[model samples]
Target: MQIKLIAIGKTDNSNLITLIEDYTKRLSFYIKFDFEIIPDIKNVKHLSEAQQKDKEGELILAKTQTSDILILLDENGKQMDSVAFSSYLQKHMNSGIKTLIFVIGGPYGFSNALYNRANGKLGLSKMTFSHQMVRLFFIEQLYRGFTILRNEPYHHR
Candidate 1:
């Protein structure tokens, strides 16, 4: 299965972008992984938190396809260890899904439609993080998970 990361905004920091690229490249060795950045909504400063989420949610939904499995990288969702995370990927790959899209929602979080559209949710940690930073963290973890799955030296218990 191809794994894609769909995030709401761009990563302005050069350092973060470099790290994200590094992990993203490493991930390509194990699976077809791509990070797609959805452009930030216009005039978001004038909108309320709910409105911003709704607008971002529309962009998120637009990027998804009917056959894709949508998984939200949310804070309140289930948190699993590295080993279990690898097994989770194994299970999905075995299920024969065409594409698996993991979303990093906007700062205000997801809308009702996004929540309903998602098939599952997985949390990285309880601590709050910027959307840009979460992109790097999640991608790195994904690379690590695949390395662990292959019994490679990239990941150590």
Candidate 2:
């Protein structure tokens, strides 16, 4: 299955982009991977948190197909270790899914509509992380998961 990471806003830090790119490249060897950045909503000062999330949710939903399996990277979601996550990925791959979409929401988090559309949610950590930083962390964990599956040296016990 093709794996797609959809995140809100651009990543301004060049260092983070470079690291994210490195992992993205490595992940390509194992499975088809795509990273999509949705432009940040404008005039956020005029809109409430819920409004911003509503707008972002519209944009996020537009990028997806009805058949795509959507997973949100949420704070209140299931937290899995690297090995378990690797198994999770394997299970999805075995399921004959067309596309697996993992979304990183905006600063205000996801809307109720978006949450309802998701097949599952995954938490990277209990502590909060910036949206940009989460992209790197998720990509790295994806790479690590693939390495573990392949019995590679990238992830050590």
Model 2: weakest 10-residue lDDT segment is 107-116
Q: Give the TM-score of candidate 2.
A: 0.98
- lDDT string for model 1 (1-157, tens) is 8999999888899999899889888889899987899999989889999999999999999989999999999999999988899999989999999999999998889999999999999999999988889998899889888988899988788
lDDT of 2 by residue, 1-157 (tens): 9999999999999999999999999899999999999999998999999999999999999999999999999999999999999999999999999999999999999999999899999999999999999999999999999999999999899
TM-score for each model = 0.97, 0.98
What is the RMSD, in Å, between candidate 1 and the native fold over all Cα?
0.8
Model 1 residue 16 CA deviation (Å) reads 0.6
For candidate 2, give the lDDT of residue 43: 89
Which parts of model 1 are misplaced by more than 4 Å?
none
Model 2 segments more than 4 A misplaced:
none
C-alpha lDDT of candidate 2 relative to the true structure: 0.96
Task: Write out the backbone clash pairs for model 1.
Answer: none
